[model samples]
Target chain A: MGARQTLGAVTDSDSSKAKRATARGRLLPANQEFAVFATVAVCFVAMALTMPSFLTLGNMFALTRGISVLGILALGMGIVVIARGIDLSQVAVLASTCGITVVLLNNGIPAPVALGAGLFIAIGIGCLNGLLIAFVEIPALFATLATGLLTLGATRALVLPQLIVYLGPENAWLQQFGGNLSIGLPIPVIVFAVVALVMHVFLVHTVLGRSIYAQGDNPETAWLTGMPVRPMIVTEYALSSAIGYIGGLVMVASTSLMHLQIADSSLIFDVILVVVLGGISLTGGRGGVSSVIAGTLLIGILLNGMTLLNLDTQTQNIIRGAVLLAAIVVDSLLHPHDEETSKQGL
Target chain B: MGINLSKRLPAIAAGAALSILAGSAMTLAANITRDTSRQAFDTAISGKKVAWVPLWMGVLESEWTGIMKDQFGQYGISLVTRDPNFNNDAQLQAVSQLIDEKPDVLIVQNNSTTLLAKELKRASDAGIYVVQMNMASNYVGDAYVGVDYTQAGHQVADELIKQCGGGKTSGEVALILGEATAAPSIEGLKAITDGLKKDPTVKIVSSQPGDWDANKANQIATTVLQQYPKLCAIHGFWGPMAAGAAQAVKNAGRQGDVKVFAISDGQMGDCDLVEQGLFTKALSNRADVQGITLVNAVLSLLQGKDKPGDKHLFYFTNNYWIESAKDRGYCYKVDKAK
Candidate 1:
């Protein structure tokens, strides 16, 4: 009996030790979490101090609404970047697809049908990008870049050639998407929030989501483990394009105009900046939804504060660039490279 | 599916046939006309394609293009257009490619005077008729069809001089420029400076470029208010942007103390802003008249009545000041119902 009790105690000790190790591995370090939290806190305090109206609810709502489209786009971009791939064509896909939808609706197509067709078109572009990158073995960057130009050119050629399709008065259903929910809160904010929640769940709860991380971490290992790596890559880009389409829709709604120029704007760079700044490693397989939110909030706060402070556009641009650089430096410092994960195409 | 297929088949067939017919008609039209302007327009353009590029096809450019397209399109005139969506390089490249296409007429809206000067000269020497629209270029083309910006600038400066120039009202004045290097902005600024020379007591306290952005104008006005407590008047180069500047003044609790002035393309937004007392005054350029004039010019050119360099044809549209809320007609507004 004595021997059995001693053995039981030893077994219990081993199990508890194993459980503690697993917990430690699964959760982020407290110090690291604290540092991130502190960065956000510091940004908020700085903005509040500089701009008298920065802390107001109206301004906060406006800032969130303004960043919603970019944030949504970055969520998908973050996913693609996490999978060891980049999509330069995301904005182009959004513009072309969204532009098509607006033109179709203007020509009397039903709203639902136009939206479905637009989203499909975006996915098709994404699939094309995937085929070139995965099957043809073109570099992701070049493939997306080429695809972006093609999409933009095709849009110009096929759609309303050089016209601003005004949908503000024609489409009430579409306009409602851009309208405020409760005075200050816009529908775009809600859309982004819902999307962020779903993406968080998807990344945490699903088998495919895990595979994305695995693929990003080590593509060969993922393939060796019987994962459908090529198809998965296609799906990843498809998701990005689909999300980009939604972002475009929100953009048209917010701006009250279907501008073909959005794709060519500095918007894509801003999206990527948000992703990278939020602690999502461009090397892939590291960051998730939380990182995106943090990055977006930081940027949104900075821009809102600048707006409130009445900073000139040039000065605002300079400050934004500087902040992005600082964020990158901080991220690099925090996540020192590990040889196994840092190499390209892993 | 069968019903949809049948419906689409006829539509597709009609589209194809219509396109083919249109193509043949254009070809036939191209073959029938001869260049009447080549000898006279030779100095302006003789050996090159004139690419008329605008920010985009809007009511303003459509009128301009209607004239050019009708006249130029019939005369075997090879006109190319690049819709830049207000982008700078796209405009530059369109001009460059037109140079490559070698047309004889290159009419353009200077996105800014300096951005396309080198290319404009290249087109000129390469032998292209370079007619600049409402804006001037650093490199003067053979002809410029636009307003005398300096005159407009002086007009506004004189008005401000009467109201606030002489330490009589507050001695503080603000200037809002469009894009920094825009030809109109530079010309307007120079004219205002020249006019200010006549009024020694007018102290211009703040001058900044709003980039022709309405939101930016508002923000700039906000900051200027913070900097100058006794700003008596504000002058802006564009209508919509000026309205935004006015809004900022109003928001800062200085609407009566600060007066806003601007120049506009008679867009309804400017008129509406004016009516709302967002602006103290706005100089209006009738974009509708401009458009109609452009169409008329194109028709005249196409009818084989005039050559390119025979004489410089200028259309100087009237500019009016909307000094009161009741003066809405002075500015142009696009009817949403239309």
Candidate 2:
């Protein structure tokens, strides 16, 4: 009887999949990755037309360098969002971990050890977020939000206590991560690109990756099929936090200071905006690596263009909001509501 | 889950209690040593508690705190700080909580001119001497110390007039403010613009709030540059954010063309940027001096024979323009090894 029910569901899914395939063919027929490719292309053209300096090597490099940290964080957020969860504490965890690392480094601890310990603490925070959301059954949003606050507060109390930790001249290796590598490419840009590629492979080609989709698609179904749903959730959050820590390291490297203030900025919201704009349905089970890249590129292009145009922050915010809203509208039209989609929180 | 919850609750409660106790102890100690003389303050405030509540302890605020922590520690004043982290409600609540704990002197860095005015008034009214730092409030409490922002702004404007307001360069200038509503930034920008009336050649091409964000400043600088290529100078209200404008200029291949100037709380980061020629000029309100001044103001209020309403003391620190490598006195580089 269980087998028959499973088979029936599979058949239903198969038919829906067929319909989706047909729809995708009609709408995005030429390129399988048309959504991401088209968005990047459009952003490039728009920026180049609006700002003459937008296409210059110097400006382009700066834009890429600026977005590297954002891209890294968004990559983590994308993974968590794809797994039918969200980690708002990523930035806060990053800040706390990075702040601690700086303090440790300042105290004469080796760079590698400090970096490792920081990453570990970040992962631990992610696990805490996971434990709360998965075991306690708290909503991912509230759990991560609460954790973010806790981590930031705790770090401020225990570490520098309202101080900015400036990495000295001795921490040259760490600085190099943010500084330039080759002729014009920043180390952070390279790191981001590499991380993106790794995440792409992990999300697309691995069994764990498939499980993430399964968990996102239908938690109940995934559990029924013998998948460890709670553990999967933990893994996803852990991965997000780990990536977020690296992003924090990149931020500190680029800026030469570990500022606890970064966590308080509207950065997490921007991460979520990038993820959603990339067509990662808040309903989950739909978006993947391509979505994050697409979203990051769109935001990067918009920001780069705005910078090149020398638009004020307020106007840039307006343009960004409008673009995000437009993206949401497009996403909604493309992916209509379904019962399975209801399981993932929008 | 139940066990974890029980464990976490106690840990959180303990942390809260410890912080409160530490906060109270610092205030009580500072109050206890109120009778100490000016010559004795360097020793009297030693080991005493001085709790600080800032709107948010950013790079600028932290530098002031760092100087205080070091100087006060050497003198025997224990500094306990509560960072509201830019939340107005949180700041108010922290102040109320800190006041209840009765710190010797509650030093507050107000977000707006008015957000903390009522609470600050209440603190002084409750016999807790309040030291308002850098930013002022309508309350005009026991002691007000820090930069004369209006004066600083006027100075910057006067300097700009010398540079661009004359017939020397295209007088097209831009103003990058920290926050639109922030009293200091707003007043400073106003003063500069008002001061510009002395010369008709200066045209304020773009004046926008960057929210004290470097990235935002970069974007603003870029746009303003594109709009007015002959822009002579961009005056930023904060140092780090001004660095963004400088970066934007560099990125635009107009580093030498457009000049970037800003006012900062003498942080090494700001000074370093200036020394690197990322900024044309930086008006640094020496944070270490301000920190010492804040300690002195609090000590005076605590020990002074004057009652609460008698005479509200105000100390204005001098601002120095860091124009070249030779003018880096405003900043103190913190060497952790020391």
Candidate 3:
């Protein structure tokens, strides 16, 4: 979720092309993002009318901070989805690896070393998922699903036999990752914003990022143009894991505990939901940072408003399910299934 | 379930003054042959196979298992165990298979009240005495060894009222409960509400389900704290999830100001949180001590001649309030080496 993509980023060479596309494609993901933003605004207005607490500054900060983890995760998921892939193992990898980091820290290891080890393992798992899908020719669905279980099982057997890993008191400063800045913004929200900015620049301004789009659009065509498609897919998954780790760290800082049970819970589904709800298509090669931000905001608003109203879990789930269904319907109408998308069968 | 939270809990209860006596049996002396009662106890318990199926082996379950294993080993009872990990379907399958094995007694830590109700009934029907631990199901086993959660809930509510009500601070309290259908969240909530009825000043502004996840609890806590900056206290149904709520209070710069409480299954980490001042207090269901109670339940079930379904018994483990370092004993240590 980056700052809404602006025309200012368009150079002379791409400006005409961008403007022409922007004009015809109110049907584009950006337009979809606009629709999402409008929906969020509408939700905010409605909630503000009914729930006097909703528009308060404290609640506003809370809403933004609370969505940071989901927003960060959705950004990573956005990258992978843009590359015509999915990583069901994202939560598993993040929880295990980050939990391992806390495990190390609790065991008296230095912070950097613990974090480094966790990062290394996270990237390794991501690479494994990439290799399986790209080289072994396994579908992303089965590959990531299998790897998710494997990661969880291996983690349980090796380090985290229990479901949670509590951060040690000696390393209490690590909590700063989730603490607020002087300006009242949470560190996690800032991190989410920074990550989104970097992702947006990478996606729009980098050769590797451009190649990812081409590869996602059509692997055969991209391969014909010598785009190093396989390696790019590997990079996308690896990057996704790296970003997911950051989100996990923020989560740990906020909660002071990482319960690996999240991997078993419906959390990964929530991550994927945020990603897809933000305009990232399962059919792939669509949506961007702005899309993710829009989706996260809408969800964040919905969740915050519900909690302020003290809605029960079942009611929240029903509302979430309804919103998700509506988004899917809106998405399909905007990006009609073609030969390729139909083949993908999202 | 450190579900990888932390490796804690040493042999906290093994050598404690845990009197393992059930029915006519008494604690055996060192010289067993000199005592006919010891011999009789040995005869009744020895060679008996007790099978256990937990939701998953979390710190609480492990603590109970360790005590059971050591005691059962000494008594010559063969304890068969299955770990379904966390899958409800797998738990059902394992219970079915264990029932077929026809162990003398079957112990299950039900994930939900209904998931294993029928299986428990079938096990009882199969002549296998059933022992339900921590949480009970619809089908009453031969014996149950855990908290009378409604009573526990009343205690929690009373504690919350004492800490936050009577216009002490902001009487607004938030509850981050476990899974909605779980006994702790459902019955515990109702009882807490029932208890809170005594305090007209106390207001429960938000009661959200954390689904027993710390992160979910943290998010909900953050929002609730924001909505009521003067929120006097936050109560969580479980410790790990409450840690998240505690952190949110800390993040919001309201640690001592916003009291945080959890009804914890006395894990070392739960105690550690109290020691660190993250939690104002915790109502610890002494899991380590519960292990002794669990062993007693199983032994009684074995020695009794009544039919499984006919001899319905409930052993409510006493709960302790963990407020300081001295109360840390209430929390069990994990068998990290194991």
Candidate 4:
């Protein structure tokens, strides 16, 4: 497995350790999520004090809406990351599957059936990825990357050879999902919330979710303990792909068109950034749903503020990179690696 | 007639035949110029190699390639096209390899202003007629044929001013750019910035790079709208990308109130947007006619005796303002069968 070198992953989250971490102070929390939330709060306060428009209801909706699709994708990425794996194909899968769904819709397929077919294709790709990573024993990163490319090429050849697929007016129902609610909540933000809540429940309250953590904590012991790790691997990837499809649909709804070139964009990196920024370890087994939400909000706030300031992309990217690096450094300082984990080196 | 009938008949017959021969000879002389021109064109264009490297075979590039094949193939010109698929390095490699083949003409559509600048210059230095189509590089090659992006941008800004500037509405316009480094974005913004100088009331509230991704444009527009609720208009650099901004405005329920403008290569989708009122205006760059312009540029270069890279021969493409259904011809229909 191409397990990347990351910081000493906290494989245990026992209450004793949590109480001790709490005793340490308000400066450090039991996990990465609290620190991220605090960061968002402080930044929000700082920004609001300076800019009158920063705290408006409409701006809040705009900020959340901007990151909702990314947050949705990160939810899936979070699941895969939790299982000690990475899926580079999330963006690619979404781009192609969503484009195909629109094509079907244009060809007189009912919205449910067409959308379901797209979901089916996405799950199929996820299975292929899991098969390669689990049964074939390839690295998850390479497996998903290849499958993503294959899916994009196949979709282009079979359905959307053109780079863009515009939504027809007959499918106006789908566009409604992109609209904002009367209460000023963009539908995408609500979609992210529902998906996040479901994902949080799945991770916190289910046997399969616990098994994913166990599997990521120690794969060999998990298998020896009768966890059926291989099947779980397939399930997580399918979940990832399926969630990615939903995000893609939202993208279609929001944009009124899907540009296949998005697969070629840097969107996947941003999704992973949202996941990892909130402390989802690449080595896995440590983070949870709060981590994903925190990450989304942090990135969303930063991006929203930058947009409001009218900063250039380069400056925004620089600030983003520096903040991520600084956060990681601060995290490492706060939670120094133990000798055993350092020697094991993931 | 009584003296020598047969002899006189011979003379008269010869005279009539002489006059008819003279008449036919004049007709032949009149046809010679047209025949020679065609012959000259065939001689100049036939057996010549034209290598076209599009930024990638997207819709516009494909349309150009299709037209070139149908026209160039007729004149016995062999066209070798390499689609870099929007990758700059691959494009550079393709142009370099084509230059090595010493084609009589090289037509390239650049994705960047400088990716192929060196290669284009080298090709010209090697005596290959380099014609940059639609998008050109920083190093001016021989005979550039593409949009007068500045003029197009000025016209668009002037239109925006009429609709939104000079106390027309909010005087707030946002520009959703693709790549700031791209020629279209750079020139368009420059011209728009300059155009706004004439009307100080027309303030550009926010300009951001959407990177030509519709989703990005959507997100940016959503945020900008929140920041400037009364944003009068938005100008998206390209049609497909701007479609996102239009949708964002529509999502904000400002479809007719907040105008959206886009510059498109007349992809029917853009025209469809205008027809549906999603887009307030579209500056249509007719790629179909642009293909003809490109062909003529190649033909002119091939027939001329001037050395490659000696001087610039440029053709600024025509821009048609598409606002209503009557201007549908400004848009070119794509073969979905492709």
- Candidate number 3, chain A TM-score: 0.90
Per-residue lDDT of B66-130 in model 1, one digit per residue for the tens?
A: 54554455444556777776778788888788778876567788877689999888876775666
Candidate 4 residue-wise lDDT, B269-315, digit = tens: 88889988999999988887787778777776776667998779888
Cα distance off (Å), candidate 2, residue B115: 1.8
lDDT of 1 by residue, A289-339 (tens): 988888888877776666555456578779988887787766654443434
**Model 4 bad stretches (over 4 Å):** A1-30, A331-346, B1-32, B336-338
Task: For residue B146, give model 4's deviation from the true position in Å.
Answer: 0.9
lDDT by residue for model 3 over A5-99, one digit each (tens)? 33322332456654653453454554577778889989989999988888887788899998999999889888889888999999999999998
DockQ of each: 0.08, 0.16, 0.69, 0.61
Residue A47 displacement (Å), model 1: 2.8
Cα deviation at B82, candidate 2, in Å, is 4.3
- Tell me the chain A TM-score of model 1: 0.88
**lDDT per model vs. reference:** 0.70, 0.75, 0.83, 0.84
Evaluated on the second chain alone, the candidates' TM-scores are: 0.73, 0.84, 0.90, 0.88
Q: Flag regions of model 1 displaced more than 4 Å.
A: A1-37, A335-338, B1-63, B75-104, B122-129, B147-288, B291-315, B318-338
Among all candidates shown, the one with the greatest TM-score: 3
Per-residue lDDT for B244 in model 1? Answer: 54
| Winning candidate number (DockQ) | 3
B81-126: candidate 3 lDDT, tens digit per residue: 8998788889999999999999999999988889989888888889
Supply candidate 3's per-residue lDDT for B159: 87
